[model samples]
Target: MFSGLSAFPLTPLNEKGIDEAVFVRLIERLNAAGVDSVCALGSTGSYAYLTRHERLRVAQLAVQHAGDVPVIAGIGALRTRDVLELAQDAQKAGAGGVLLAPVSYQKLSDDEVFGLFDAVTRSLSVPLCVYDNPATTHFEFSDELHGRIAQLPNVASIKIPGVPADPEAARARVDLLRALIPRHVTIGVSGDAFAATGLNAGCEAWYSVIAGLFPQIALAITRNAQAGNAREATGLSGRLAPLWALFLQYGSLRVIATAAELRGLVATPCLPLPVKSLQGEVRQRLAAILDELELA
Candidate 1:
């Protein structure tokens, strides 16, 4: 599993399918910025939005251009069999590991969640990281469930979101996971807003959204926390607060895509139709914010 700044890239897309040229450019930019690892088809990548074949091709594209950097493919799907097939295909495509989250068609029991991961991990030669994103999955894991999952063979990490809305609580939660989970299993803090606090509280990795647009900012925060520079990390996180506010209000996918568009990184604000990217007043606010940060 990825142990440092693992950027969740927004898969640059065209109206019909994946935009190969723009996607390649994004990966090349990430590699040039020296992100520790990149996760293709993550929540930001809109994994569920793509066809199975599109997902496979996206992984192939990412792995081909990853160079020396490790690529972790998101293998989440609504069905167990689909996730399993995706994991196998990811390994075949030379992905370093697979990021699996229990996607629900209906509310899942704890046993059902365990079973889904168990089936996928057992079938994989590569490592598996459990994505513990309750907001999207709507299945919050209990502490006991987390321990049980961590002990699973070839299970390598857990991603926990830490938004600034709940800093002390987020830190306390990270602290508990640090104590409860095995040393071998890394805990990654997602939610770019609260990453600094989570990192200071001892999260081993950051699964970041901001890094998809501004890797240097993301890398600096992680490095600062790793070096015990809490003040510096906190400051960077503060600078990112405006963007995070937009994320909390409008979702990270939309805001990050707007940031990419503002920078001329992608051709158009590409999201699945009906799920619009930022527009009008929000777009103007985002442009102003990015300009203030000198990121536009």
Candidate 2:
């Protein structure tokens, strides 16, 4: 049950398999930045693009470089058995916990969803953190269902995306949903764009993509917000506003991949086939912002 800023490093891919040297260098840089925690093979990590062997290799590298800090292995798949096997692999690879999401082509009923979680909980040895990314999955869990799942043992936390930009509405939602979670269970915000508002609305920690390239700024904002420096946090958020806007306005996946490229964190920001790259104004805007921030 790790908290605070847990950065999901984007696993750079090339024509070959898992770019080992680049991946290792990225992990070492993130660890040296004093990150609270790191995750591999998540959505940002391009897990869907990797094979089973590649996922396992990346997970091993992440855990190896994580040192004492907790390593969260993102084990998400369309099949129950496959997800379970990956979870088992993560535990064997020295991961501290597993981040599971309901990944299925057919939209399942609440009963089916509950059943899937029940089986996963019973099968895994380590704690499980459920990821609620409705944008990608198109199935958002109701608070009632979350309340039921939170009661189970070995369930560590829930990752909720902070949709609906209005801070007031977002705050109300967080407060209500947080009540459904047991006192011991932690709540994290995954929407990097609205993370500041989410944190102000009672989120204990967050999962950020921006932290991959600019961990120092992300860490500064986290510390400021946690220490009750609202103005400072808001100011830092403004500094990051350009990048956030690009992710929201344009292609989020491209912007994220490009950030790694601009920072020289990865050899090439090559996304999976069918996922296009940014060009012209979009690429120029991202590059200019990164330059302004001196991320290069």
In terms of TM-score, which candidate is strongest? 1
Q: Tell me the tens digit of each residue's lDDT in model 2 across 154-230.
A: 88888887745676787788889887888877888886877777776767877888776677888888888788886
Q: Against the hidden reference, what TM-scores do the models get?
A: 0.96, 0.95
TM-score of 1: 0.96
The C-alpha local distance difference test score for the whole of candidate 2 amounts to: 0.80
Model 1 residue 127 CA deviation in Å: 0.9
Relative to the unseen true structure, what is the C-alpha lDDT of residue 214 in candidate 2, on a scale of 0 to 100?
72
Worst 10 residues of 1 by lDDT: 161-170
Give one digit per residue, the lDDT tens place, for model 1 in 227-258: 99988998988987888899989999999988
> Which stretches in model 1 have alpha-carbon errors above 4 Å?
163-171
